[model samples]
Structures are given as C-alpha cells and as structure tokens.
Target: MEGRLVLALILGVCTAIPCHAYYSPSKPYVPPTEKVTQLHFFLHDTVSGKDPTAVLVARPNFTTAFNNTPIPFGSVFATDDPLTVGPNLTSGVIGNAQGLWASTGQDVLNLVVYWDFGFTQGKFNGSSFSMFSRNTITQTEREAAVVGGRGEFRMAKGFAKLKTYFADFSTADAIMECNVTLIHY
Candidate 1:
C-alpha cells in the first residue's frame, strides 16, 4: 500500500511539471514594385526603284526565310504577308500587303531586326532593297533598310528607343521589304 502511494505521488508530481516550448513570430513578406515601359514598331517599304514596289511579294519570301532560320527563346518572328515575292523579277507588281501588330505587353522596350539568308539555297541575282522607319516621342528618330541579291543574303539590324510609361505606342511607318536568298537546309 505504501509503495503504491509513493508511485502515485511520483507520477502526479511528474505530470504536474511544466514544459517550456520555443516559438518566434513570423516575418511579413513584401513584394518589390517593377517599372514597365512600352513601345511599338512599324515596318514599311518606300523605294523609288522598281524593286521598291516588290515589297508585297518580298514579304512572304522574307517570312519563309525567317521561318526556316533558328530563333532563340523569348523572341518571335512574323510577317503580314505570306506569299512568294512575285511570279517573276520583271512582274513589277507587289502581291503581299503589309500589316502590323502590338507586342503582348510592355515588356518589349527594344527592337532588334535580323535577316537570315545564310541558309539560302541559291545565289541572289536580283537587285532589290527594303526601307523602314521608327517614330517615338521620347526617343531619337531612326531608319533602316537592306538590299541584296536574289540567291543567298543575310542582314540584321537592331534599334532601341527611350522607355515610356504609357501602354499605347506605335511606329510612324511600316517596315520595308526586298528580295532574299533562299537557302535549303
């Protein structure tokens, strides 16, 4: 009976003892604010020569050439027209009409132009050129163009304008087009 009493007393004392637990307050999370800028690009052709009017047909050729080239991630390539340059070099008729598009968001603040004819299959024999212009309120005005043979030619240009806070922006003119050397891989 005495042993039982002692054991009960010991168990009671053990159960009554307090245990300390460690804890700390959680820190508040904060997000950083990012500034966004937007810009629009327009490509058109304005040439006095016979090849200048060939832009319509050249657009599709350009698109085909671009599609055949390997593009890096986070970048895209496209064109308003998707047809052959023309039935023949002497046709003097433009078939493909030009069009434009706005970037998905304000993430694209700089414009980089690239031409890939290195993979062109035949030799460029035709004489043609393409012209383009850029217009912006807070940036310097600029123009770009390229002229090359009908077989295999490669040209690239890059343009960067001042960043703007507005979401609506566009170029003053359209991009130009010319003959491209098609490379068969």
Candidate 2:
C-alpha cells in the first residue's frame, strides 16, 4: 500500500513540471503600408512605315496564314513604340513601350501582348514597368495587368486601361491612350 502511494506521488510531481525550454510562443508579424501611383500616356505603333516601330518577327505555317479567315493566327511582332503624354505623336515624349505582341485569335481579332514601359523624360525617369495582357482589338477599350517594375516603380502591381486614340488600317499604324493605376513602396 505504501509503495503504491509513493509511485502515485512521483507520477503527479513529474506531470506538473514546466516545459518553457521545449516550447515558446511567437509574436505575429505585420507588413508595411504601400502607396499607389497613377500614370497616363499614349503608345504609338507603326508597322507599315519606313521606320516602323513594330515589325513582324514570326509567323505560322504558310497554309495557316492563307486560311479561310482574314485574321492570321500565331503572328508575332516586336515593338519599341514611343509613349507620349497625349494622343498625338507631337506631344511630350515620356517613354517607350518595348515588347512583343501576338495575334492569338483564329476567328476574331485578339492579341496577346507583353510590354515594358521604360520612362525617359519625366518624374519616373529611368524607371520601368511591365505589362502582360490579352487585348480584343475589335473592342473600344482594352486592359492589361502590370506585372512588375524597377527603379521608382519597384515591386509595382497594377492594371492599365488602353483606348484606341487613332488607327489607320491602310498603313497599319495605331495610337493608344493608356491610363495606369498601381501600388508600390
């Protein structure tokens, strides 16, 4: 009977021991506040002029290009078009939209694009932001996602709304106005 009581007491004492050395609670982490910036500009793309800003870089098979549809599928073009302050080319030059765009639609007019806006003469000079999007050219308005950026727009995430300011089907020249809103440091 005495041995049983001693064993019970020993067990009870062992169970009451503290375990701070093996486990410690952690504090919650908080992220820093971010700021937002809005930018407006225009992009001029010329594919038929002597000094065309956009050039045909790739195309699909010959049979595919001459398909029943008027629109060519899998046609890729590289562009280093100018970004201006206004819809007109004579407006202030701010940046260049350097990237590639591809016609992905087989029936209608749809283009998948990736562009980098490299600023030159502005408050965000030397800074650059990137965007990737699928634009339905038949529509009046188009939107693209601003994936990333560098310099003043570091870690930028946002969207850009583009409207066709001018277009010449005969010459394959277009001017688009872009309104961009983004969040950054």
Candidate 3:
C-alpha cells in the first residue's frame, strides 16, 4: 500500500511540474499599426533620345536625378522605356529606382524603388522606404507590389498599387500614381 501511495505522489508531483524549463506567460495578442501613403507625381522621360534602357525622374525640380542625399528634389528610377540616357543618375538627387528586365518573352520589368522621406515637410520626415514592383508595362494596370521599409518604417510590410497617368510611347514620357498600405508595429 505504501509503495503504491509513493508512486501516486511522485506521479502527481511530476505532472504538476512544468515540462519545459523556461515558462513564458501567455501574452495578449496585439496587432500592428497600419499606415498608408499615396504619392502622385510625374515620371519624366529625362532620357535624351530613344534607347532600350531609360532613366526616369520624379521630383519637384525636373533637373534633379535620384541620389542618396536627403533632399526635397525627387526619386529616380530606371526602366526599359525604349528611350535611353546615361546609366548613372545626376548628382545631389534624393531617391533611386532600379529596374531589372525579367524575361524577354513576357517583357516583365522588376522595379525596386527607394524613396527618401528624410527631407519632407510634415509627417514622414526621416524615413527610408523601398518598394518592389513587377510591372508589365504592356498592360495598363499592374498588380499590387510588396514594400519593405526602414528608418521610421521599421518592421514594415506593405502593398503598393500603381496607376499610369499617361504614357507617351514616342517620347517615353509618363506620369504615375502610387498608393501604398503598410502594417507595422
């Protein structure tokens, strides 16, 4: 009888003890904050002439190309617009855009755009944000792209939608609208 009792007590104690050495209390789930930013600007065809690779600019001033400097000028991106210019961007620009041709058959343009919010006037004054766009320029509208942010947008994940305002095939000039939605802590 005593042996059986002892075994029962040991079993009870063992079960009472936690299986894991470290026990973390359950935390209440907290959702991340959602942020959305919309930018409407002209994507100027800054290339001098017709070429396969084109460097496009979007800034308050038409002269400034995309650069790393924190300024209010604009962002620069490259695309295969059939219009060409120098591969390098002009000095003293704010943001950059890089485009990689995915496939010749599909004519897919993979765009990675970096926008510097450091020199802005209000709300987003010192943030570095980047977005990836798989744009099939042949199509009028493209799917929402993924965006990962830095600086003030730490731990941010989002979707970005682009709408073409205008596309001039001859001059390779275009205007675009971007709407972005992000969820971050």
Best by lDDT: 2
How much does each candidate deviate from the true structure in C-alpha RMSD? 20.6, 7.5, 12.3
What lDDT score belongs to each candidate, Candidate 1 first? 0.31, 0.85, 0.46
Kindly list the per-residue Cα lDDT of model 2 for residues 1-185, writing each as its tens digit.
Answer: 99999999999988986855686767786765787999989999988858999998887775364254333688889999999998888988898999999888866768898999999996899999999989777777988899999988888999999898887756658888899998876
TM-score of 2: 0.78
lDDT sort, best first: 2, 3, 1
**Compared with the true structure, what per-residue lDDT tens digits does model 3 show for residues 1-185?**
99999999999998896777686788998866665555432233334455533454443454233223322223344453221122223312233333432211212333334432222323444654555555554467665555666666766667656667566644444545445566654
| Model 1 per-residue lDDT tens digits across residues 134-177 | 32222344333333312222232233332222222232223323
lDDT of 1 at 142: 38
Report the Cα lDDT for candidate 1: 0.31
List candidate 2 segments past 4 Å from native. 1-30, 63-71
TM-score, cand. 3:
0.46
